[model samples]
Structures are given as C-alpha cells and as structure tokens.
Target: MRYVVQVFASAFRIRKIVNDGEFCILYSDSDPSIDCIYVTDKWILSNQAKPGGYYIAYDNGDSEYVEEDEFKMRATFVDQD
Candidate 1:
C-alpha cells in the first residue's frame, strides 16, 4: 500500500510496511515530485508508527501548516504513532 503525505512544501508516497519490531527506512532514488524523508527503521518500529497514511512528523513534532484544516490539500504527510 502507498499513502500520499505532505511534509512542509512537498508531497510524496510512502510504501506501506508492517510495524514489526524491526528497523525500517523510507526514501526515494529519483527526481521525486515530492521529496521523501529517511527515517531509521528502528524509529518507526520503536514508535509503533503506522505506515500508509498521512502525518506531520518533524524534529519538533510541530508545524503550523499541518495544523491548518487545508493540510490535506497542501501535502499529505505524517509520522506520528
């Protein structure tokens, strides 16, 4: 499965993965219409973060844009468990 996520000003698809207690990483290898983010596989598993959805994952776990109701239109994104 794949999910459309928006991070800041970019949008990208995240290939879905089962949240097992193992390391996982998400990235892109070409000119992506939206930039992809790299997260330690362990991070996702540790956080029990579900895949194949939208979220607002950030260093501070805060972003005004994502808080807006129009977030879905701007870019579909996420990283919260």
Candidate 2:
C-alpha cells in the first residue's frame, strides 16, 4: 500500500514530507502545470517545521484534512510491524 501526504500552502509553493522509512518525500515542481508532492508508504509525516500549516493525508486512495498535532503523532508509529 502507498500513501500521499501534503502540507497546505496559501501560495504556489512546494511542500515537503519527511521520509520515515519506505516512504520518501516527492516534489512535483517539474511540470509547473501542477504544484504538489507524492509519497508511498503506510504513514506519512507532514512538515512540522511550519506551524498552522494545513495537512492532508491520503490513504486507500482517499484524502482528508488532518491536524498538525495529530499528523505528527501518527508518524511515530510507522514501520512498527
């Protein structure tokens, strides 16, 4: 299974997600047609460096807005199995 996590930005900017294990941060700035990032893993960690930044989690092909605090907490449990 794969996952995609995105950090919300007001302007057209690149957001990065930390690669905890099998997942790696992906930047899609090459096309310029679309601005986004992709990830492949069970869980994704959002960029906690920026506070108040909106975060979205995509799992099982579904996306939803996630809280920053909750996002960080989830990242800790990755790769436990």
Candidate 3:
C-alpha cells in the first residue's frame, strides 16, 4: 500500500493517493508519514503544477459539476543526488 508525495509551490506538504491492486484510477498525493485507517470507499488525488498553480481533485460524482474532473498529471520533485 505505497503512496505518492508531491511538492507543490506552497510550503505545506501535499498528499495524494495512487492506484490499488486492481489498477483502478484511485490515485492520490499526500504526506509520506500519513499511515492510518483509510475509511473511505473513494480516493482523492492531486494535480501537476500548471501555468498558475496546482490543486487537488476527486471524482465521486458528488460535485456540482456532475462530471469527470479535468486535472493535470502528478507534480514532481527532484532530489539532489
């Protein structure tokens, strides 16, 4: 049950959930130390840094849009190696 950690332009840490055993699109990005009970049947994912910025996105059909969300890919960070 691995997870993804994204570094955005903000100072706060960003967490997002990724896929599961079935390879369904349950992707997300969140803090790395967040190890706890996931009590949701759904997943919330983040977005890639865009022209202005980035944000988190989800698809549970509970939004006022009532449609699929349009979000960018995952944001990336480079380690000094």
- Top-scoring candidate (lDDT): 1
lDDT of 1 by residue, 29-79 (tens): 222543455456655645454444333445545422122234456654454
Model 2, runs deviating above 4 Å: 1-54, 57-59, 76-81
Q: If scored against the real structure, what TM-score would every candidate get?
A: 0.32, 0.27, 0.17
> Candidate 2 residues 5-44, lDDT tens each?
8643222122454565665554432235445544554434
TM-score of candidate 2 versus the correct structure, residues matched by position:
0.27
Task: Report the C-alpha lDDT of model 3 over 38-69, residue by residue, as the tens digit.
Answer: 21323232222222222332343221111122
Record all residue pairs in model 2 with backbone atoms less than 3 Å apart, i.e. clashing.
none
* lDDT of model 2 at position 7: 40
The order by descending TM-score is: 1, 2, 3
In candidate 3, how many Å is residue 71 off?
10
Judging by TM-score against the true structure, name the best candidate: 1
In model 3, what is the error at residue 43, expressed in angstroms?
Answer: 4.9
Clashing pairs in 3: 15-29, 15-30, 16-28, 16-29, 16-30, 17-27, 17-28, 17-29, 18-28
